[model samples]
Target: MKKPSTDVLYQEESTYVDMLLRKSWSMRIAETVAFVLGMMILAQFFPSNDTTFKVLAFAIAIAVVGLAPFLYKATMRPVYKLTKTHLIVSISGKETSYPLSEVEQVYEGRHFYRLGGKKESLMVSRQFLSHLNERLFYYHKGNKRR
Candidate 1:
């Protein structure tokens, strides 16, 4: 009934999966230390006297530790722009736009909201909660008359 606003209201690029996996900086340090230590300890069971075996194990451990974040980040589905009229969902690199007027269900969460339409759903940051609620409320209210 109304023209969709083009101005971006609240935009966040972080993904729902990332929010779940992201740890505090200090916690990350601890985990990394633990992994390295665990790998080195496991290396102890090799039953070999040569120091090269221990060095090889250390190298493998470091490689695994370094590559882990990159591996996880590659699969993160990013939630793109949140505008007054549209929410963009991005998986890989493709973007899909969902109209706010079509929103049918809102699954609110602690840090994110799962906005569901008739055929699809997308996760968004809590920063858009107020705007989403106001818009969804009015959208549903208007639909009730028909």
Candidate 2:
């Protein structure tokens, strides 16, 4: 298939996010689950004759809960954009554009497209799945690789 140039990919307007709609609410809920599990695990050690283990677990759980929000804030969310010829991913503002010709497969995950081979895969949300199918169908059909 034909490859798109870097210039065209970088200049494209389409940007999509893999993040769920609830945003922070969803993330916090997941983190809260971890906090509950950690507390349960700590509870197992509470009855132990060894006091140090209990104290350590308690301290660790508290520390994790306290730092959870800050850690989530510090984490970098990758940005994805689809151009006429390339799949672009940006993390911490650094953009890397991959030619759409390299997309060997389109359907993998439910909410995201696993764009790349086993060595390293970029996850772009399925928001562009329909357009991507439209763009790449000709290439795949031309070569009978679909």
Candidate 3:
């Protein structure tokens, strides 16, 4: 088989926050079930007045939907990008170039890349990566030795 092109390999952005926030296959199902059950429970407690029931149900419905996006963002995975000119990190928009004699390593972690150096390190996530290539990433970072 032909070697996978570096350009193709690094096209997608995988944010830690995104992944974490995604309702798990099971969680989505559970949420649906809970919504139904909660509605039923609340309905039983509803005032005999139809208006009161409608208002309470509407409020609960709105609150659940409103919180979904925030919950997803909080739990979702972070993001990063690897391009030829520079390694663009998502969280902070930091980009580091390759070929620099100083950068000691590049490795994947749970939600970010660890770029090691004698003095400090650079960490990037999916949010930082943009459309680019590995060569461009190296060139942008000053073409330092890998």
Specify the highest-TM-score model's number.
2
Q: Residues 4-116, candidate 2, lDDT per residue (tens digit)?
A: 54443222222223332213344557667887787678768676556876687777767765666445435654555666667676655777666766664533543334356
Better of 2 and 3 by lDDT: 2
TM-score of 3: 0.36
In order, the Cα lDDT scores of the candidates are 0.56, 0.54, 0.44
Give lDDT: candidate 1, residue 54: 74
lDDT of 1 by residue, 26-145 (tens): 435755776777667766776546687678677766765565545434675455675656666665778767777555443454333434434333344455555566666766666431
Better of 1 and 3 by lDDT: 1
Ranked by lDDT from best down, the candidates are 1, 2, 3
* Candidate maximizing lDDT: 1
Tens-digit lDDT string for candidate 3 (97-144): 432232333333332233434232222333333223234355556664
Give the TM-score of each candidate: 0.45, 0.46, 0.36
lDDT of 2: 0.54
Candidate order, TM-score descending: 2, 1, 3
How displaced is residue 129 in candidate 3, in Å? Answer: 12
Error of 3 at 56 (Å): 1.2
